[model samples]
Target: MKQDEMIKLGISIGDLNGIGSEIVLKTFDDSRMLDFCTPIIFANTKILNFLKKQYKLSLHFQGIDHPSNAIDGKVNVVNVWKENVNINFGEEDTKIGEYAFRSLEAATAALKKDEIDVLVTAPINKATIQSDKFKFPGHTDYLARELGGESLMFMITDNLKVGLLTDHVALKDIASVITPDLIEKKIRTIQETLKKDFRIRKPKIAVLGINPHSGDNGLIGKEDEEVLKPTIKKLRDKGDLVFGPYAADSFFGTKNYKNFDAVIASYHDQGLVPFKTLSFGRGVNFTAGLSKVRTSPDHGTAFEIAGKNEANLNSFKEAVFKGIEIYKAREEYKELTENPLKKQGKKI
Candidate 1:
């Protein structure tokens, strides 16, 4: 794909009652965004119209039956459902969960069929989205299973990239699930993603410690000393530029994260707190290490502010751009790898 080529962006309309439709409507409000990529929103046309009318917005999009009919210079919506579903703002129910999953399933089907080039998922209720058909911790886990690869919850921006070994696990169980092997696997995925997806030839990664002060040299805990340090050493010995069981407290405070290309958090909060704090408004939650490109806004379904038309579209907009950027980068990366010896022109 060329730099200015139109990438098909598949968007699963998250919980309709939340800000998913709002942000989606707002993002495509400007037709200039259409120049960059054609957005195929997997959502109910009627639901989107309701939001548009409620806000008195002019974000008109064409409703189509399939992504095959997506048109450039227009916002396209593929209907996943037809019935007029009532939206009770600031509410959670099983019906809402089912509705959200319908969009996600349709979008992923398109992704698998290559109908869409990249995906920008809207926020869904984690608790609600857990049905028999969709049984996983979150998007990363669900996509990992569906796509047949390990997924890393990578927070990405121009300055910092953070990947999580243990995603959506309770804090208490994070230690049990995040072993050295798990760390190495996820880190390896991040390394490869940085190289291929982001075009970082040699990426430096930082691993934050689970314990305080990396277990204070085993004073506070031993997991850092016993598990994390040894893991870093073995990975480094294998020629990966990975560093540290750095203490979570000072890792971002001292601007240490600036020294690396990416950081791996032991658990969700240890990484997300600093990440959201720094990149919340414009950051992207990129599901790295997958065969496909998937990015979402850093925040969740803002039920409180859903219908108020007050949602910030920066993060969601960034998610859309990030998806396109990664797609282009991966394509270019594949070209380079496919013709590796071409770099030297068969030099003697």
Candidate 2:
């Protein structure tokens, strides 16, 4: 947040066989953006250069040995691998998966060492990124273990912000994980993120029900009527503007989500299905409750569009800007929290 030093942005190139490199390159093509922050990409220069050629891009990247040695105005690349990896677009192979993990691992190290201010990751093939070393489902699980925080997946955009109770889990596994405790923890994390990261002083959060008709008065399911309603009551008593056990089907369709600052969905699909439907090309997945700042584009690898010069860079660009905004917001929030003010009563 110090204005003296440029915010060093660390990026992990996702599955090389996908549209990660294409979107990343397009996001940094505008040299004027360098005036704001510096980017340090963790990937092989050869791989990115291949993407560049395929896309017919004129942009040049500076190969740096270290993140700290990155130039101010140029797109900086720290080669994580030395080999010239082949570009096999639209394939979920072991080689690209290993490469993606290598880049993410190295970038995460730089983040922990305070070499970068924020991390904006490219999309990785979650199924393929599995290996002996990295066995997590996706970025949230891996980053949660690496950073040691109760990471919650939040989808952010200018229009709406939604966080999930269970992220990157199988549908069968979600039912077991949907305990009252998990719901409460995820909402708490979302509340804190809205306050600290997004700078919402009194965040009004809306929680969605797990069932289609919110259990239809317990005829379909009891979790919504029994678990969610009571949890909202408890969380609200603790001084949070929490509301809802509304059915997910009608919440967004009726334009009700606009009334709250943030929404907590019962699971990943319940939240993301609506979020991506509205803000598909512009949404950013923010990992809230982590000590370090991390975000990624809302969309996935888009294997069909890889190397076709059809990938949209809007989401990736917004991810970088969102990272910078959250970092600044956190700094300001810390300053405000440190200097306490005298208590005052509320006026109706």
Candidate 3:
């Protein structure tokens, strides 16, 4: 595909001290990826080149000043910085975090300006990346602020998808946050995303309970009975195929998750633990309910294996592929929704 014809993939190079750069280089090293989308990596070309040499990668990339200068058939790097910073592998330096933020900031700008069709972010050290400018916990919060949409952290693979109701919140605060309004909104977001992004026409969603065995029907706790049960009933009455507040303990073990289109967990670990276990290297962390498409690898910054060339690039590659797929799906959905006659004709 030519430049205008192909999707422009905006890539943010995450913490230089981590495996972000390694996976990014390795993923684009495959020549076949270029045929799918034009990758515009947001980071210093000099830094990338240094890492490229360090890893002994044969990937050739051209330096560009902006995303518009990206060419279709080759990897393009936007020089977000020009300074030469020392790269110490496996080190958690604040300076390294600044570079990661710079790349993400620039890539997000391009995305907002329509310079890029989709964004695939590499892993970042959440701790080191914090600054006065970045008060949010992670990418989803920041992207939601910038992109102007309700965002859901949707971890996905081909078969399974998990959405979080309360991500990055403390264990004590999980229940206080799970109100009826919050549950409804999140479920709505998941439902819309499944229909528009994944093309699931009638999505059957399952919700995991906040307490063990769903509070053992109030014997273990009343939050499941008082909060989740009623809220779920309201949604079901509204004709949504939403079920559960199922016991988190046996939900996955019983293979009940396979019966639904997606599972909504109350907190971070409740959903991600089982998800990462099942789809570790193959899953993509997709930020759903945004007007723009954004995805990342399922894993985080592996500081232990930063520059060792021991990083697995499958998740990163899947993130790239998933970003492209969602973008296309959204575009098709827009066309069909904007002109319902065309959709009806297709049905006929």
Candidate 4:
């Protein structure tokens, strides 16, 4: 893929009632977005028109019947739904959930067919989307099943990059899944993803301990000492720059996360709480180990402030930009890997 051949990006419009539509509209309004890649929004034209009227945002939607008909330097939207369904901003509705899932399915199909270079998804309501027709925990699990890869969720920001070992699982169940093999698998996934996707050479990973002070010599918990420590040692021996079973509480505050390329969190909130607190609106959620590139905003569907025109579009914009960055980086890394001697003569 040459730089002149514009990368085709597919945007899955998440829950219509949520901030997904708003952010998508806002992101396209910026002309600079076209400079990097051509965007195709998989959404209903009626819903987008409604948002335009409600928010009074400056955006023009060019609906295309086919992907080949998509125009450059314009917001090309593939209208999935024709009817203008009732949308209650901030209210949870099964209809919106269905629409969101449909959009995702369409985007996923396009990615698999190589119609799109990258996929940027907006926020979706997990609870409402779990009905009879559409049943999945969230995008991570759904995407994993669709793409056929070991999926790992990683939060990326300017300061911290953290991956979850067990995501969207209960706190009690986390320990049961925290085995040496699972930990090692997640670490290796992160390592390979950083090198291949993000183009980080010799990535250093920090694994977080499940217990406080890493079990304090087994006084607090045995899993940290028994399971996590051994996993870290095994990875180190395998020539991976992996360290710790580190204390989760003190690690974030001491700026230790900056020292590593990525951190592996034991569970959800153990890493997300700190990550969101620090990089909430600016953070980008990237799904690693997938066959295709998928990135989304860190925040969820903010139902309370949905249609009030008060939702922030910064995170979605970052998600789109980060997707482009990673895609370009992956291409560059592939070039270097294919011809290492070519890189030898290049400037350092």
Task: Put down candidate 4 lDDT per residue, 1-348, tens digits, no spaces.
Answer: 886888898999999889888888888888888988899999877778878889887788889876667789988999877877888889999888888888998889888888888999999999877766567778988889889788999999766899999999999898898888888778888988889877788999998889889899899989988898887888789898999989999999998998999999999999999999989899999999888899999999999889888888988888998898888888888888887876897653
lDDT of 1 at 35: 82
**Best by lDDT, which number?**
3
Q: Cα RMSD to native, each candidate?
A: 1.8, 3.3, 1.7, 1.8
TM value for model 2: 0.96
Cα miss at 188, model 1 (Å)?
0.4
TM-score of 4: 0.96
Ranking by lDDT: 3, 2, 1, 4
- In candidate 1 the C-alpha lDDT for residue 333 amounts to 78
Clashing pairs in 4: none
**How many steric clashes between backbone atoms does each model show?**
0, 0, 0, 0
Tens-digit lDDT track of model 3 for 10-116: 99999999999999999998899999999999998788888989889888988999899999899999999999988899999999999999999999999999999
lDDT of 1 by residue, 1-348 (tens): 666668999999998878888888899988899988999999877888888898788988799998999988888999898998988877886798898999999999899889999989999988888888988877888777777677889999999898998878888897788787898889989989999898888999999999888898999978988999999999999898999989899889999999999999999899999999988888999999888999999999999998887999999999999998899989987877888876567743
Tell me how candidate 3 scores on lDDT.
0.93
Please write out the lDDT profile of model 2 over residues 1-348, one tens digit for every residue: 566878899999999888999989988888877887899999988878878889988889999889989989889999898998977889989888999999999999999999998999999998889999899889998999989777999999977999998887887786677887888888889888998998787889999888878889899878887788888999889887899888899999998999999998888899999999988998999999999999999989999988899999999999999999999899877866765452133232
Candidate-wise lDDT, in order: 0.89, 0.89, 0.93, 0.88
- lDDT-wise, the better of 1 and 4 is 1
